[model samples]
Target chain A: TQLLEQSPQFLSIQEGENLTVYCNSSSVFSSLQWYRQEPGEGPVLLVTVVTGGEVKKLKRLTFQFGDARKDSSLHITAAQPGDTGLYLCAGVGHSGGSNYKLTFGKGTLLTVNP
Target chain B: EPEVTQTPSHQVTQMGQEVILRCVPISNHLYFYWYRQILGQKVEFLVSFYNNEISEKSEIFDDQFSVERPDGSNFTLKIRSTKLEDSAMYFCASSDQGPYGYGYTFGSGTRLTVV
Candidate 1:
């Protein structure tokens, strides 16, 4: 079974403090995606990174795919209270016929206090 | 923006009872998926549907679990006999492309509580 290990399962920080969450795996992935989920809702896609060593930014958030394609990271800069939520990382392998068959990490629960 | 829609925001059923979770994928999406998140656990993939058939499913998808695209727009997941462990938030999702194509859009989810 492919497993994704996410670090810092719970984070509580003051507003404006930057934080980084890491997702690591032993198997290579064809692509990786980040999602943010709020209470009473399903996850919302944040970004998708297909290439190793690729970096993508969405306003205050930055996502990076590891050079080996086995890991990824999400960094929040000058975090605001609105940034607080559950962050998840899901990986898609190359061999799955569905292409979108995902293996997900446990996720990081972030809380930014104002 | 287009979104995946699910019905019965919450459900409660007795053990051994049958329950069907409904989802309406985006009109233009070609791939459909079902996932569940046990309280405090990671979101886990249950099955993937394409071309009106199941393309893949996880081990958790056992004999008690089945999926069908009953109509042109609706995808349904049926749990033949519910168990306490089946209680979780079931999410329906759809994607324009396969996993490699683009990220999927997920519905708010149905919270199933099996008594």
Candidate 2:
């Protein structure tokens, strides 16, 4: 089974602090996606990284995919209370034919206190 | 923005009872999927549907589980016999192209509690 291991399962920081979450896997994937989920709600897509060593930025959130497509990272700058949530990383792979599947990480729970 | 809509935000049922979780995928999406997340556990893929048939499914999707796109816009998942272990947050998702084309858009999810 392909598994995505996420580091720093839980993190707490004061406002304005910076934090980074890591997702690693032994299997290579065609693409990787990041999602943030709030309580009582489903996960909301944040960003997707398709190319190896690719980097994309959204406001204060920076996402990077590893050169081997086996890992990814999310770095949040100047974190605020609004950024607090369960951050999940999912690896996308083709099962067969046109069918694709997403294997998710356990997720990192972040809490930003003002 | 378009959204995937799921019905009955929460449900409570007795063991061995049947339950159907309903969803309305995006109007333009062609691929549909079902996933479940147990409390304090990671989200796990259950099944993928396309062309009115099951394209792929995980081992967790056993005989007790089934999916149907009953109408043009609605996709439904039915569990014939609920087990305690089946209790989880079930999410329905759809993608316009494929996972590689555009990432899946998920619903708010239905929390199933088997008693």
Candidate 3:
């Protein structure tokens, strides 16, 4: 089974609408990161939440890390067409030695139509 | 800000042929990694190279897959014999010492299509 799971495989909303995507896992993560990828481009870092219960905001996007460090959420307020892209959540595991490995979720394809 | 750069943005090769994908990681980064994403699938880690050798690798990185740092500035992933299933977007990433608070910076990616 895939180590990480992301819900709402797809999302579509009109401009100014709100939407939320989720990432869940049975194992705890040392840190979680949210990224956005445009078609034909590499994913771009959005936010990284390290501490449990941490909440971070970047413009209209808000990211939250679960208390158990096993889940995360990204909420977009007043979504804009510019927000259309593939959203992916990656968990950084703590196996050993700086633990640079990252396990990625299946991803959520989001479309914000104007 | 420094970024990872991968070459041969797009490569097309016939199945069973040998192919080499090249990447130039950030000058100051210590960790180097290669990842690939099949169409519509999640990005998956292939292998990681550090200190002139491999540190970790996923099961997908089979014997056919090999990595080498031929010089001070280049890291390359070579496929002894490519297969149709090998078609995917391959990305190279690098990180500074922190390797935590700061997320990995990935290259534009090389789109490999095997026929």
Model 2: per-residue lDDT, tens digit, B1-115? Answer: 9999999999999999999999999999999999999999999999999999999899999999999999899999999989999999999999886856365899999999999
- Those runs of model 2 whose alpha carbons end farther than 4 Å from true positions after fitting are A94-99
For model 3, the chain A TM-score is: 0.95
Candidate 3 C-alpha error for residue A65, in Å: 0.6
Q: Which ten residues in a row are the worst by lDDT in model 1 chain A?
A: A94-103
Interface RMSD of 3: 1.5
For candidate 3, list the clashing residue pairs, or say none: none
Give the best candidate by DockQ.
1
TM-scores for all predictions:
0.96, 0.96, 0.95
Give the per-residue lDDT digits (tens) of candidate 2, residues A1-114: 438999889999999999999999888888889999988788898998888999999999999999998899999999999999999998888332233678899999999999
Itemize residue pairs with steric clashes in candidate 2: none
lDDT of each: 0.91, 0.91, 0.89
lDDT of each residue in B28-113, candidate 1, tens digit only = 99999999999988899999988888888999999999999888989999999899999999999999878564848999999999
Q: For residues B1-115, could you state the per-residue lDDT of candidate 3 as single tens digits?
A: 7788999999999999999999999898878889999998999989888898998899999999999999999999999789999999998888776455364888999999999
| lDDT (Cα, tens digit) per residue for candidate 3, span A57-98 | 999999999998889999999999999999999888744333
* Candidates, DockQ: 0.77, 0.67, 0.64
